[model samples]
Target: MLNKDCHHNCNQGNCPFAQDSNNANRYVCLKCGVEREINRYPSGFGSIVMLLLSLFIASQLLINWEKQDNQPQSEPAISSLR
Candidate 1:
């Protein structure tokens, strides 16, 4: 079991680890005895999703670049004014 204290500084409401600390709000992790801001999303899932998305996007971009490079460039049309 982890013990947590909330100092009531969080405006997000319904914080699981917040307690009223007189006039100021602070967060304390009961398990580790560390005080800090809590993130809205869990770190593990967010990091994994971001990593996969980046890899997919990068691969798509690389494929497009390779296709473009393999294509021959056409000469520009000559202007009569030149």
Candidate 2:
């Protein structure tokens, strides 16, 4: 069985895995010696994705604005001369 799942059959108040004294992000199973790391903050991958998404949206808005600005205005119709 996986060390992470070691507590599956453990009692409600009892678990084999405990936090490592040196690292708060690590959890070790006393029975199997398996370790896992916890991530409190997001990774750089998420930041990169958000940055790209925002840039895409900003570029689209700028393109639409420029199109509106470049469109020609309607001219008044000239009356027919007698």
Candidate 3:
């Protein structure tokens, strides 16, 4: 059972009454009792933000790796026989 906060009339037998499953966006219709997936954020802004954030983190890691690879290594100390 979801929050049941929806308060819209079913003009065409499509009023969302309950969720189809737990942690799912699909909802059951009130008039016809049909399960339908709902996209509350159809713009997909969250996905875009996550993608950008991932790309930024990946780029930072790559830059750090390249810097480490380009650094010059120290020469080993040699001991001379007395």
lDDT of 2 by residue, 7-70 (tens): 4544343447889899887887675666667865658867999999999999999999999999
After superposition on all C-alphas, the RMSD of every candidate to the true structure, in Å, is 9.2, 6.3, 7.8
Clashing pairs in 1: 3-30, 6-18, 6-19, 7-25, 7-26, 9-25
Candidate 1 lDDT, tens digit per residue, 1-82? 2323535533333334544375234576443444554465567988999999999999999999999999999999988985
Cα-lDDT of candidate 1: 0.63
Supply the TM-score for candidate 3. 0.45
Better of 2 and 3 by lDDT: 2
Q: Pick the candidate with the highest TM-score.
A: 2
Instruction: Give lDDT: candidate 3, residue 43.
Output: 55
lDDT (C-alpha) at residue 69 in model 2: 92
- Tell me how far the alpha carbon of residue 12 in candidate 1 is from the true structure, in angstroms, after superposition: 22
lDDT, candidate 3, at 48: 97
Candidate 2, residue 61: how far the Cα is off, in Å? 0.5
Expressed as tens digits, the lDDT of each residue in 1-82 for candidate 3 is 3224445556545565687667478777665555666776755888898999999999999999999999999999998999
